[model samples]
Target: MRYHFLSLVQIFLLTVTTPVWAAEQIVLNYKVFRESLSVEEISRFAQTGELSSSLKINFALARQNPKAVRQYLTQPVKVNPVFLDRVLNTPLGNVILDQISQVIHTPSQKADRQALRAALVLSARQDSQITLIEIFKNYPTSEVEVDGDRLESAYRQLRRLQTNIENLMGV
Candidate 1:
């Protein structure tokens, strides 16, 4: 009886400690080429500005600047989670989310819209700010796939959305 109680307690503790879901790998898809990178590698680069060997090689193959990638990963766009949530629920926000989802989505391409919405809201709720890395980290999936060629376009879309939102708020 005592052993059964201890086993139950251990099970509860493990459940509480584990993350329900989070992106473990990022698959960058460019044309017909695809490369996978671990979330830890990206997060470390964002925090320390140091790229792993695999990342460096991938950047070279993709013709992407590590510095620029790091910049976007770390740049924080301040937002109010409540307001963000409201906007994201609107028609216009749905359009924007749909566009962004094309660039960043699940490996199976299922629930892309919903996953993007959750990632955006959770990222903002974490620090009242959203960064590309934060969104990637919060994505509720085991693997997140990105259209590497359309990455710049996606970033532009996000910036445009943020600007419009701020203008409307008179901020």
Candidate 2:
């Protein structure tokens, strides 16, 4: 009986103390472009090593008009939708989407725009409303390794997709 109890205790300890292995992760690097890194700023910085004088104020009021904003948003953008779907299914992608949904604690905008933004953010594909280019700027871009078991092909493709994402960041 004593030996049985000791064996049980040892088994319990082993089960309790064993380190659990985490899920597999797929790594990917990407850059997001939002308001701060406007094209004008990029152009000026490229040519003169500094942002334009107008950008110095960086006030919303001084920025482009509604028409210009619309025009800019109307420009064509490109992305890989299939790749995006695979990413959105991943842990890191899910987290990103969750944060975005959290920020939208309350809904105010049109239904179409809201849905499109959510789709574009995860889909990594171009839509009518916005693109990654419009979401981040001069911000730190990093490779993502999502937590969860995934097929080898998924990880392999993600690494391949990273090149295009990195190129976009450079643009």
Model number with the top TM-score: 1
> Which digits, one per residue and each the tens of the lDDT, describe model 1 over residues 1-171?
355355888987554334479899999787767988998988999999998998887888888898887887788878777777888888988998999999999988888988898888888877788888888898889899988778776777777667767866788
Where does candidate 2 stray beyond 4 Å?
A: 1-64, 98-118, 121-171
Residue 8 local lDDT, model 1: 81
Question: How much lDDT does each candidate structure score?
Answer: 0.83, 0.35
In TM-score terms, candidate 1 sits at 0.84
TM-score list, all predictions: 0.84, 0.27
- Candidate 2 local lDDT, 1-171, one digit each (tens): 355345888886554333122112112111221223343443334345454554443323344343333333233345455545555566755554444433221123223223423435432433422322233221122111211122222333334445444454463
Against the true structure, candidate 2 reaches a TM-score of 0.27
In model 1, the runs with Cα more than 4 Å from the true position are 1-19
The alpha-carbon lDDT assigned to residue 171 of candidate 2 equals: 38
What global local distance difference test value does model 2 have? 0.35
Clashing pairs in 1: none
